[model samples]
Target: MQNGTVSMAELLNSSSALIFMGTGCSSAVPNAMCLIQPSDPPCSVCSQSLSIPPDLNPNYRGNTSLLIDHLQSNGEHSYILIDVGKTFREAALRWFTFHKIPRVDSVILTHEHADAVLGLDDIRAVQPFSPTNDISPTPIYLTEDSMNSVGVKFPYLVQKKLKEGQEVRRVSQLDWRIIESHHEKPFVASGLQFFPLPVMHGEDYVSLGFLFGETSKVAYISDISRFIPSTLSVISKSGGGQLDLLIIDTLYKTGSHNTHFCFPQTLDAVKTICPKRALLVGMTHEFDHHKDNEFLTEWSKREGIPVQLARDGLRVPIDL
Candidate 1:
């Protein structure tokens, strides 16, 4: 078994990470309850490291709702939400309703696909305090190619306009952070180190995986069709067994899928990455929680690894 010892940092630097392992594909979100909740006040399982946000408008229907929450707490607690899928409005409302997320300081885009970035406008929920308070725009990070895609999708955000006495827009006007990179470039934004994992999505130059934070790290790879050799090297090099959690897309079951990781393929990745914990996300109606729980429980016991089947409202903490 891997070492069970935990590391302690001096002065207790404000560093913490959270993984919201749930399905984000297009399926109705399934309600889930704590499997490990206790029968008492201030319940432990009820108040796990992760909490599901409340439903605001209550009109969220598309794909499965598997949101990812990667947070860091050293000096000030910072949070990053990767891959705001088509259901971003719902996802944002759910997140804000459930947790005390201070503010979405910044956002990092994985790709320009609708499923990955359709939620770009959801940041309106966290603007500065006002009745009609014009809140500052939050910084969003993305590569040049992805930025082009964003400009195409959301033309209003990137289109330049000639305003008298305004050659450049003020920081508060636009919620953007242009990241100069393509797939596989080591890009840093908002005190977060992001390594874009080069992936194949059926010859389409879309989709990206990310490794976030500094000392302790979390890796997120969703909407990935194939994990190429070079990207594997980057992940292996940057991983350093310092990975507390790794989240990946496991869309299909055991069948062969051309553009995504099947069950066996995801298993192989787990064997390769060997994270302290591995969570399979992007589930669908085909993959039932009740059945997956049984399968994963047996699989974990046999494989001697901690493997979890992510649900719509489950939270996994990564703090050392």
Candidate 2:
């Protein structure tokens, strides 16, 4: 294999999942306004990390996104991306470019929030290097509600037409497919099947989390305030009552939010699911890598489960 290229064989042989970006909420880590000055009083998480500078801190994360790679029967690689958010372009340039990821075979959206779908235009960057040459555009699997919102937000991309006298620029060529939120019947993308697990965003909204792989399942729920009972049951059945890895939303360390999970809720969900390992995502500036790690280490031992924080560029083998 080349130095930067990720071969299908490498991905298929792995036993872990790669977390391209990890953070709760849309703001991400190292918030500009939250940065503390020398004269300012210490600000717990952000204050202690100033010594290394925000740019240099490896813990600084982007919006939540996960990359799942699989090898097709024809010896081709399939890269599936979940949730292309506002920070996707920067994240891609920072990491995906260095790794030489050719193209995204499919995109499965969780919801239509700006932070989750604003980067649809950035898909144009991958068109030139796409391995597939079929007439169909890149496939994007999403729910009906999300599809409508995406069309409203990015009419040019969805409708494949430019406004009158509009300056011509490359836009994403996508084939939107409506997905059913049924865990029993999964949708296949690039040889890998995904089971949509529905969860509650808040009192007024809903979101979908995906369960991937067969024998050793990996569940990814980037933004959720609560899990539906049926969804939890599906997750449990995916791994015979214990998932291989559960990547969940942990938006804040404390305080309550109507639409995102706090540390207590996140921990409770993790415990209920009882995954072999858990990696928390969707974090904010309140979470300090150094401090959080220490706390999670102790918590993991106490609970008898391995849990850790997910950071950008962190790769784990998806051992199926």
Candidate 3:
């Protein structure tokens, strides 16, 4: 753990990359509703998903999540995961294996929604099941409210105890670390400094986005309906006033959502942040990756900023 602030030189030299573990909404792409209904043309995006391999199919998305792959100066490969949503098992099986990623070094959660936190138990796959195992418990970073909800949803994980007269069952051994999202405090996980960018998910609920990286700034806002002024200020104050990459939530091609950004809202936020490059995530079946990307390509040409939809399994290396 970096107990103090790290220098820009140290951060620049340490190799790291971002992985889009999943880029779909709660139901993921190829929505069950669309699949069940019989239509003349059918759901174009959902239909194409059936014919291609997942690695090659952008239409085949999983729940929104990100993985930070960092190669420390000491030669340790750190895998810091963000938000283990309901589709986390499928994401881990497919993306982790395909990318050859090892065990998760830590987990940073966005919020307590079922789509974001329901897969907490599945993380046990990477940890030692038996108490005698030598591996240390995985550290989990989340806000207090998120932890409270998590406790209600998975009492076994928080308490880590067997009930009276109940058989022993293995659960994920996690060290809960609460980050004060309201305070917008910065925390270091696996050697990277992450600034919590709190945004409104709904009128009464706030979700966290993250602004991290040193030489090449990257911001992630995977579940936000609207950006609060504080988040915009943080983004504007980032290195040299330029964000290298931004992966944000875009729930639909059009129309405003109550808890997720639609196409217009996403674009408004993007323009406000003015990132050098942007990738939209958390999309429903309304978007066709190829078609939507073509549209974004033209928009990028006109705006002079790159914008595209993020897909599951995409890895973006941070370069100098």
TM-score of structure candidate 2: 0.86
Question: Model 1: per-residue lDDT, tens digit, 193-306?
Answer: 687776776565556777765655667777667777766655552444436677788776778676677788888887787776777777543465556778988888887668
- Candidate 1 lDDT for residue 137: 60
Residue clash pairs of candidate 3: none
How high is the CA lDDT of each candidate model? 0.59, 0.78, 0.85
lDDT of prediction 3: 0.85
RMSD of 1: 9.2
- Say which candidate scores most in TM-score: 3
Rank list by TM-score: 3, 2, 1
Candidate 1, residue 176: how far the Cα is off, in Å: 3.3
TM-score of each model, in listed order: 0.73, 0.86, 0.91
Candidate 2 vs candidate 3: which has greater TM-score?
A: 3
Q: How do the residues 249-307 of candidate 2 rate in per-residue lDDT, one tens digit apiece?
A: 98878977899898989998888888989998888877877778899999999999899
Q: For residues 226-264, what per-residue lDDT tens digits would candidate 3 score against the true structure?
A: 778767877853523879898899998888889889999
